[model samples]
Target: MNIHEHIEKWQVEDGVHLFDKIKLPDNSVLIDFGCGYGEYTISLALSKKHSTVFSVDKDERMLKIVQDKIESHSITNVRLIKADGTLSIAFPDCYSDMILMYDFIHGNTQEKLPIRFKFFEEARRVLKPNGILSIAPFECEYLRDSSGKRRRYSLGMLISEIESYGFRYSESIDGAVHFDYYHSPYHWKKLNGEMSFDYLEIGPVMNFYKQK
Candidate 1:
């Protein structure tokens, strides 16, 4: 499918339901960290018009795609920010009500772990006290660390890591849709061919609250 098809699938179908399941409060301030192509960003903005959504990504090209969608959809609630997720977020302390880190964490190399820790620190810094921090580790599995030793990336391990950064795990939803540069199950039905499974990728959507 093309970009248009992907956008429709995300904004109209999967992404909307996913956000709804996550129960994003209306009129809350949200930041989509490492927002790729603004799939979740656009979906959330359209779903909750009263809310302010910040679509942040380091790549300008991806932000441009989001911008076009925003203009086409006449969406006014989304603000685009170009920033590296590993570094500081361009927001005031305790600013946002929630932060979404979907399909963003992977590769537990020694070098990458520190960067992720920094990102988590930023997430904690920008979120309001007791604010929500939702994460979907789409590629959570066995990974080789810098020592060349295999480490299993389980939900428990991830929860512990985030907890160490001052977040308390609240809840987790299983079989959460993981959207990225891949076709959804709906795409296969369009071609009169059923996909082997429901979704191309599914993972746990873990919600946490920032410690005061």
Candidate 2:
């Protein structure tokens, strides 16, 4: 299958529609953390025609995938950064309008939570006022292995940790929830107490946590 089809399969397998949750402002500068290949990144770049996008991933193999894409499509608006997920990203203060962590935290083990939180803290620092942020948590951020299929997290830890970084709050997408994530409205509600949001709840939707 092609990338779109693959992402769809991933959506079904993981029960999340990452692409749909995000709401981009015109000319926004967006970043896709942990962007694997260039599927969603390219889609975001193409969709947000006037915006600049940064596709960040530590895996060098995927760089070629993304490079092939940006080159083939002749798209100049994306910047690819190679760095460790938990390390502080090198960007100026308040530099981004949107940041996406697609299955980023989940990949790190418990030992890395500090680093993960640091990334979030740094992300919050660099985010512009009212900037958007999205994360796709595939179960516990600490439990790396095959357990995600069995051990589901409360999302409370994830939410609290993220909120502690100083993001204000926003609503969630709640209609037809993504079929892949296995998380319900209750999960989102639990994650963001008293925070409200708009939900596409459908395939390819984005789940946004705006900068306070």
Candidate 3:
């Protein structure tokens, strides 16, 4: 299936099931950072109708797509924000219950670590005490360190990095599907008619809680 078909299926069927594993509390304030194409954002909005979801992205086109989806589904609880790439969130302190960072953190290069840390600080600032920070670090297997050396990325490394930013490793949900377009390698094979598969790319969703 094409991207649109996959998105439609995800919003109506698969995405909701995927999000259920995270066990987000109803009526909470949530943020989907770097909400590309808004697949997860739409799914989140649909699944937790009472929750207020903020879909933040630097790209206007992606936000437009999310807006269209919200209008089509008559979802009123989702707000879209165009990020300015300053590693800053527009909300006040202790305003959100959760922040979703699915498929956003990648590369892991030395130069980018400071930016990531800054964003983590922003996340900590916006989340209420003990709030959730869910992350799915897809495509982060290989990374370069500060000395231009290659390093392998692992769950432990991720946990350590997050812990340094005042978040405690809470839990992780395995077998979570990555819904982004380029992240699913099998989709390309299907597009080229090389092979057929019924499954999407699977990864783990790591959840962390803010420390008071």
Candidate 4:
């Protein structure tokens, strides 16, 4: 299956639903970092619900894919950029309504350690006071497989790191991470009460909000 279908196989369509939950005002601008194939960005901008939605990624191939999608669908509000996903997100200060790192938080690679913090820092820079930064990594990463062969950050640990960036806690919904939040039936079913997080993890994958 293609990446989209592959992703869909593991989520519940609530990636967008979670954004809807963010509750932006009329005509808000959104920055979708690591936006792949422009699935969420295109569908969202096509709704004409935001003032502008910036779709950015470092991959030229993906940018072209998204470009074709926008052109074919005749979507006009999205501004696609072929920029690095972590650094060079160049929007003005306090200019965005929200920033989304949908499933990219796999952990900082060595090359990104220097610029890694910039992702959230830049989001903080461009976000309006009381704006939102929503990060949804794969939930499975939080726990080991039944046999305990893998290692992922615990929900509590992820929260502490984000808090270090100065974003206060809000609330975390009991839901799947990016993997299942988009389209997995069995995954979501397995998730029923098995994993839960606060909106803002004062302590993990909780929904979070900015402090005013």
Each prediction's TM-score versus the true structure: 0.80, 0.66, 0.84, 0.67
Task: Give me the overall lDDT of model 3.
Answer: 0.79
Evaluate all candidate structures by whole-model CA lDDT and list the values in order. 0.77, 0.61, 0.79, 0.61
Query: Against the correct fold, how does model 1 do in TM-score?
Result: 0.80
User: What's the best-to-worst order under lDDT?
Assistant: 3, 1, 4, 2
Deviation of model 2 at 209, angstroms: 4.4
Q: Which lDDT value does model 2 have at 82?
A: 90
lDDT of 2 by residue, 24-96 (tens): 6788888888777655577677666688989888889887788888887677888898967447766788889
Candidate 4 per-residue lDDT over residues 102-152, each given as its tens digit = 666554333323343567677788888888787665532443322433446
Candidates' RMSD to native: 4.6, 10.3, 3.2, 8.4
Query: Residue 145, candidate 2: how far off, in angstroms?
Result: 17
Location of the lowest summed lDDT over 10 successive residues in candidate 2: 195-204
The lDDT leader among the candidates is: 3
What TM-score does model 2 achieve against the real structure?
0.66
Pairs that collide in candidate 3 are: none
How well does candidate 4 score on lDDT at residue 59? 86
Better of 1 and 2 by TM-score: 1
Strongest candidate by TM-score: 3
Instruction: Name the lDDT of candidate 2.
Output: 0.61
